[model samples]
Target: MDTLIFVLFLYVLLTIPVFVLLMLFAVLTRSARLRRAAEVVSLSACAALLVLTFERAFEKPLLWIVVVLLVAVLAFGVSTIVKAARERP
Candidate 1:
């Protein structure tokens, strides 16, 4: 379990920059596909973060902030995906 948590932490750390780059490209290119990809990366990252937090049993106040941020990111990703779907022909 500790190994899994550590791996997830690493995954989240690695994806942060990728996610930012994806979002930047999505915005610059004005592509729905890029936007969707960025959201998917964000959603996965959120899931990883959530798992990490849960594995630690929410032992720290800092983890509470992580939980809040994860919830917000999940909400944002869902909303963006839904909106993109609705916009698609």
Candidate 2:
């Protein structure tokens, strides 16, 4: 399906920033836990992004639900990293 391929392409484009940020965060952070968290957050966000695209392609009314959930996840991940940074001596 051309639409599916297009959605996949768009998903890759959208996720590139998340991937770069995760890579940078993992490389810059000294804590093993932080690096592992980055991996988890990145993978989860990528999966969510893919789902969002699929939902969008089908014109699903529940697309907003996926968007909200993804935003919440990203916010949680960022907060966790910031909390760790602040607690470091």
In TM-score terms, candidate 1 sits at 0.75
lDDT for 24 in candidate 2 is 79
Best by lDDT: 1
TM-score of predicted model 2? 0.46
RMSD values for the candidates in order, in angstroms, are 2.3, 6.9
What is the Å distance of residue 78 in model 1 from its true position? 2.2
lDDT for position 45 in model 2:
54
Tens digit per residue, CA lDDT, model 2, 41-84 = 57565565756555674677677766667677777776776787
Model 1 off-target regions past 4 Å?
Answer: 58-69
Residue lDDT tens for model 1, 44-79: 988998888865655766677777777888888788
- TM-score per model over all chains: 0.75, 0.46
